[model samples]
Target chain A: MPATLAEKILQQHCDEQITGPGQIVRCRLSLVLANDITAPLAIKSFKKMGAAGVFDKDKVTIVADHFTPNKDIESAEQVKVCREFAKEMGITHYFEGGNVGVEHALLPELGLVGPGDVVIGADSHTCTYGGLGAFATGMGSTDVAAGMALGETWFKVPPTIQVILTGELRQWVGAKDLMLALIGTIGVSGALYKALEFVGPLASTLSVEGRMTMSNMAIEAGGKVGLFAADDKTLAYAAAHGRKGDKAIAADAGAAYERVVTIDATGMEPQIACPHLPDNVKPVSAVAGLKVDQAVIGSCTNGRIEDLREAAAILKGRKVSKDVRTIILPATPNIWRQALAEGLIETFMDAGCIVGPATCGPCLGGHMGILAGGERAIATTNRNFKGRMGSLESEVYLSGPAAAAAAAIAGEIIDPAKV
Target chain B: MYHGTAHTVGAHIDTDAIIPARFLVTTDPAELGANCMEGLEAGWIKKVKNGDIMVAGENFGCGSSREHAPVALLGAGIPVVIAHSFARIFYRNGFNMGLVLLEIGDDVSKIHDGDELKVDADTGVINNVTTGQTIQCKPVPPFMKGILDKGGLIPYVQDRLAERA
Candidate 1:
C-alpha cells in the first residue's frame, strides 16, 4: 500500500525499519523538549543514566514558561533543576520565561520545529507542533531521559484519519470553535490514536495560529496528531519566524488515509465547550446571555500576541461589564512585553480588564486566577473538562480570545461580532 | 514480550485521569502504578487481570503526552492495548516504551471490560472466550513487530546498534 504523509515523514527520518501501528519501532528522535513541570524529573533521570553529555545538546529545547516567577518553593525548585541541568549538559537553547512562552508556542516561533521532524515535549499539548508539519507528540520523564541519553525514541506510525472541513465558518467562529465542534461530534475519543489530517477549503483559510489551536486540542479529542500539509501558510509562518530553508513539506496527493471525517462550517454558529469537557459543546446561541464572573484571555492556546491584539481591538475604550472581570495573560513574557509596547495593555486596562503575570496563571489553576465556587468564567485556555481550572462547582466556558473579550465586556455570553 | 486475553473500555481514557499530572515527577513506577486508575471508574483497576490486554473504543491516552501513562500500565503488567484508535503522542510514547497497541474494528464495544480475549498478533485473531467470538485485528507490520519483540525502544536500539557495531 502507498504510504501516507505520516508514513513518508517517518521513513525520511527513520534510521531503521518503520514500526507499523500496534508494533514498536526504535528510532532516533530529531528533537526533544521539556518544560518546568516535567524537567525536574527528566533531570533526575538523566543523572541516573550517567551519560557523558547529551547526544546533541543543541537539539534539546528547554523553556521555563509554566511557572515564570518561580512562584513557590516547588516551582522554583523545578526551574532551578532545569537551569542546572541545561548548564551542565551545555545545552545552549535555554529560554527563561521572559524570552519564553508555552513550549508549543515557542518551539515553532524559534524555528526549532519543521516538517517531518519527530519532536517530543514533557507536555500533552506538544502535539501542537504538528501544525508545523512535524510528527510531534508528548512524552514522560523516562522517555525524555532516554532521549536525553540516547537522543532517540521509539514510535508506531499510526493509521491516518482525514478530517475534511468543508464550507465556510459563520461569523465569530474561529479555529477553537472548529475543534470544539469536532470534539462534540467525535466524542473526545472519536479520533483516538489515529492521525487527523485536516483537508478541504476550510483548512486552507486557517492561519498557522488557527491550525496550531486546532492541533493543540487534538489531545482533548484523543487524536494522536492533528496535522495539515505544509502549505503556503506553513511556509509563510516559518519564513516570517526566520526559518530560512527546508521547513515546508507537502503530503503526497495519493497518501493513504484510514478514515475521512467531514465538517461543514457553513451555517455553523459560534460554539462553546462548557466547563469540564471539550466534548460537551453547544452552539453559542444556546448559552447566550448566560452571566459570567470572569474572563481569561491567554494560555498556550490563545495567549499569542495576535490573539491579544484581536481582543484588544474589540475592548478598546469600552468599560468591562460590571458583573465580569477580564484577565489577559500573554502566553510568554515576550508577547506580554510586545503587547505592552504597542499599548495593547493600556487598552485592556482602559477597558477595565485586570492584567496578570506572564505565567500559565488561571489556565493551569496553579495560581493568580482560580475561580471561586459557582463562579462562571469564559476562558481561552485549552481543556475545559470538569475541574480543569479550579473548583469543580465553578463553571468555565471556552472560546477564542475575541469571544472571551466580548463576553467580558457584555458580562454575558455575547457574540464578538455583536460588540 | 507477553500476551493474553483482552479487556475493553470506552473512549477517552485520558492521561490526567490515567495518571494525573501531579504524580509525574517521581521515578518510582511501582508507586505511580499503584494509583494508575485513581481517576478511572472507581474500582476499575482491580478488575484487570495480570497479562490481560486492554481494548478501548478510541483516543486512548488522549490528554497530556505523558510517558508515565504507558509506564503505569506496563508497571501494572498490561501486555497489549487494542483500540479503534490512539492519541498520537500516547501511541508513539507507548511503542517507544514497548507497549503493544492494536488498532482494530470499531465493533470493539461488543467486548466486555474483562472478556477473556486471546490475541495471536501474528495471526491477527482476537478470540473472546466468553462469547466464543473472534475479531480481526490488522496485523502489525514486520518493522514494528521487530521492535515489540525486542522489548521497546531501549533494548531494541541496544540490539540494533550492537549488531551494526
Candidate 2:
C-alpha cells in the first residue's frame, strides 16, 4: 500500500509493524522539547517516576523562552527549576536567558531536527518542524516526562486531509494571509484529530519560512499535524542549516487521502483574523480604517528573518502614527543578530518602533506589550481569542508582517496594497 | 461511575480562558483552581463544588499546550469533561492528569446546564438523570484506559520501569 508522508514517518518510528490509522503504536522519538512554563512540571514528573536519568541527554532540549527575563518572582523560580534540572541532567541543548529563543524557531536553525523524524514538545507550536518534513506534535508535561524517561511514546495514527494549493499568491500577500484564509474556510474544528498535507504547485513554491508559519498554527484548526512534503526547497533549507544525513522525505504518488480540498491562491488579498476567533477572518478591505492602539511583528508565527525584512521594507522611510505604538521582535537570536547586521533593527527604531529581545512575551500576554482596557492591536502573532494579549476588554487583529507594519504607520488596519 | 450536575459552555473554550497567562506563574493546582475560567466567566470558580461535570461544545480546551488548564479544573473538583470534541493535545493531557473525558457528539446539546448526569466510564454511557435520556459515547482506548487505571502517565511509567527492573 502506498503511504502518505505522515504514515511513512510513523511506520519508521513504530516499534512493530502497524496496519493503519487508529492502531496504537510505540514510537521512538528523535527529539523532546519543553520550555520554562512546561518543563518544571515535566521535571517533577520525571523525579516522581523514579527515572534515574534521561533516556538520551542529547535528545532532550529545554529552553527558557516563555515569561523569560522573568515576569515575576514566581516566573523567576520556575526558570530556576529548569536551569537546575538541565545542569544536573547534563542536557545538551538547554538554553538560558539572553540565549533563549522560541523553541519552534530555534531548534531547526541548530540542526536538531530534520526530515523523517518523530518529535514531540510540551508546547503546542512544536508542529512547526513539519516544514522540514518531520512528524512533530505537542503533548502534555507528563507525556513529555515519559518520553524523556523512556525515549518512546505511543500514538494512534491519524487519517490524512489533502489540501492542494494552486496559482501564485498576489503581491504583498504572504503565508500569514494564506493561513488565515484557510482557517476561515475550514472553520476552527474542521480538521479535528486529522493530519493536513499541503501539496500541489503553490505548496512546492512556498519558502521554508512560509511553510513554518503555516504549520505552526496547525493546532489552531484542531489538526494533529500540518505537513508539506520535503522537496528541493526543504533539502536546501536543511543543507543550509548544516544538516547532513538523509534527503527529504516525500509521499508515494498513489498515497490515499481521506479528503481533498483545493485552494486557488491567485489574487488573494492580505487577510486578517478578527478579534475573538482565528477562523473569523476577512480581507483587509472589509475592515479598513479600524483604529489600532498598538502593532506587533513577532512570535513563532512570523518572527523570522524574512518576516522582519518584509516589515522593514514597509517602514523604511515612514514614521509610525503618533497614536500607535509599534514593537518588533525577531523570533530567534540568529535572526535578531542578522537583522542587526542588515540594519533592519535600525530601520525599525528610526521609524519609532521598539525592538525587543527574542521572547514569546507579548504574544501570550506574558509581558512586554500587553494591552489595557478597550485597547486594540494589530499583530503578526497567532491567536486573538478575547483577552489573549491582555485585558478581556481589549481586542486583537491578526495579520502578516507587512500589514502590521502598514497598520503601525496608519494607526489603523490598512490594505498593504495602498501602502 | 460518578454522578453530578453539568456546567455547560460553548465551543473553542481555550486554555487561556481556562487558566489565563496572568496566573500561569505557579504550578500549584489550588492557585490555578481559583483562577480557572476567571477570564471567561468571573465568579465561576466560586460556584463550582466538588464532583461537578463540565460539558462543552466542540474543540474544548483549544489553544496552548498548558496542562495547567486541566489541572485547574481537576483541582476545582471537575473530575470529568464531556464535549462534542477536543483539541488533540488537551485530550492527551486530560488522560495524563487522570481527568476523564467523553466525546458524546450532538447528544451534548441534550444535556442542559445544571442538569444531572451519571457517567459510567467503563461502559461509555452518560445518563441524563434530569431528562431520563441515556447517551452513548466513544469508549476510551485500551492503552489509555490502562494509563488512567494507574492514575496518569507518571505512575504508569513507574509501574512499567519497575516491571523491567
Candidate 3:
C-alpha cells in the first residue's frame, strides 16, 4: 500500500501494524526538546514520574532562548531550574547563554533534526522541521518528559491534506505570502489535526529557508504539521547543516490524501495578517499607510539568513522612519555571525535599526522592545494575536521580511513592490 | 450537585489570550491563573468562582502549544470546559492534566454566561441547572478515560513504567 510523507516517516519510526490516520501507535523519537519556559515543568514532571534519568542525554535538549538574559526574577528562576536539571542530569544538548537561539531554528542549524526522523518539542513550531521532511509535532512538557524517560511516545496518525501549488511566484512575493494566503483562504481550523503536504510545481521552487518559514506557521492554521517532500533542496540543507542521517523521504505516487486544495501564486503581492489573528490576511497594498510605531524582522518564523538578506536588500542605505523603532536579530548565534559576515547587520545598523543578541524576546512579549497601549507594529513574526507583543490594546501586523523592513523605513505598512 | 457556573467566551480564544507570555515567566498554576484571560478579558478572574466551567465557541485554545493555557484555566477553578471544538494541542494538554473537556458542538449555544451547570464525565452529559436543558457531549475515548481515572497522564505513565519494570 502507498503512504503519504507523514505516514511513511511515522511508520519508519514505529511498528508496521500502524496502518493509517486516526490509529494510535507507539513510535520511537529521534529528538526531544524543551525551552527554558517549558523545561522547568518537564523536569518537575520527570521527577514526579520517578524517572531517575533521561533515556538518552544526547537526544534530550533544552534551550534558553525564551526569556533569556532573564526578563525578571521569575524568568531567571525558570532558567535556573533548567540549568540545575541539566547539570544534575548531565544532558549533552543543554544550550544556554550565547549558544542559544530560537529552539526550532537552532535545532535545525545544529543538525540535530533532519529528514525521516520522528521528533517532538515542547514548542508548537516543532512542526517547522517538516520542511526538511522530518515528522515532527509539538507536545506538552509532560509528553516531553515521558518521551525523555521512555525514548518513545504515542501519536494519533493524522490524515493528509495535500496542498497543490502551481503558477510562478511574482517578484517580492515569497513563501510567507503563499502561506498567509493559504491560511486566509482556508479558515484557521481548516486543517485541524491534519498533515499539510505541500506538493506540485510551485512547491518545488521554494528554498529550504522559505519552506521552513512556511512550515513554521502550520500551527497557525491548526495543522498537526506542514510537510515538504525531501527533494534536492531538502537534501542539500541536511548536508549543509552537517546531518548525515537517512536522506530523502517522499510520499508514494499513489499516496492517500484526505482532501486536496490548490494554490496559485502568480501575480501575488506580499500578504499581511492583520491584528488579532493570523488568518485575517490582507494585501500589503490594502493596509498601506497604516502607521506603525515599530517594526521587527526576525523570529523563528523569518529569522534565517535568507530572511535577513531579504530585509537587508530592502533596507540597504535606507533609514528607519525616526518615529518607528526597528529591531533585528537573527535566529541563532551562527546565523547572527553569518548576517554579520555578510554585512547585513551593518546595513540594518546604518538603517537605524536596533541590533540585539539572538533571543526570542520581543516576539512573544518577553521583551527588548514592547509596544504600549494603542500602538501598532509590523513584524515578520508569527501570530498577531492580541497582546502577543505587548499591551492588550496594542496591535501587530504580520508580514514578510521584505515588507516588515520596508515598513520600518516607511514608518507604516506599505507595498514593498511599489516602494 | 453543581459542577460550576459557566464563564463564556467567543470563538477562537487563543492560548495567548488565555495566558499571555508576559505571565509565562512562571509555570506556577496560581501565578498563571491570576492572569488568565487578562488579555482577552481583564475582568475574567473576577467572574470565575471555584469549580466553575468554561464555555466557548469553536477553536477554543488555538495558537501556541503552551500547556499553561489549560493550567491557567485549571488554576482558576475551571475543572471542566465545554466548547464547540478545541484546537488539538489544548485538547491533549487538557487530558494530560486531568482537566475535563466536553465537545458540545452546536449544543454549546445552550450555555450562557453565568449559567449553572452540572457535568457527568462518564455519560458525557452536561446539565444546565438554570435553564433545565440537557446537552450530551461526545464521549471521551476509553483510553483517555483510563488516563483520567488515574488522575492524569503522570500516574498513567507511572503505571506503564511499573508494568515495564
iRMSD (1 decimal) for each model: 3.5, 1.0, 1.0
Candidate 1 Cα deviation (angstroms), residue A412: 2.6
Instruction: Kindly report which residue stretches of model 1 are placed more than 4 angstroms away from their true locations once superposed.
Output: A1-3, A15-28, A47-50, B1-11, B22-60, B69-165
Estimated TM-score for each candidate: 0.82, 0.98, 0.98
> Across residues A1-419, which tens digit of lDDT does each residue of candidate 2 receive?
88888888888888687666787888999999999999998998899999988889999999899898788999999999999999999899999776788888899888888888899999989989888889998888989999999888999888888888888888788888888888888978877788888888888889999998988888888888889888888888888998887577877888888988887888788999998999999999999999999998999999999999999999999999999989898989999999999999999999999999989998999999999989999999999988999999899999999999999999899997787
**Candidate 1 C-alpha error for residue A106, in Å:** 1.1
In lDDT terms, which candidate is top?
2
Residue A205 CA displacement from its true place in model 3, Å: 1.5
Give me the overall lDDT of model 2: 0.90
What TM-score does chain B get in every candidate? 0.82, 0.93, 0.94
User: Higher-lDDT candidate among 1 and 3?
Assistant: 3
Candidate 3 root-mean-square deviation in Å: 1.2
What's model 2's lDDT at A326? 95
The regions of model 3 sitting more than 4 angstroms off are: none
DockQ rank order: 2, 3, 1
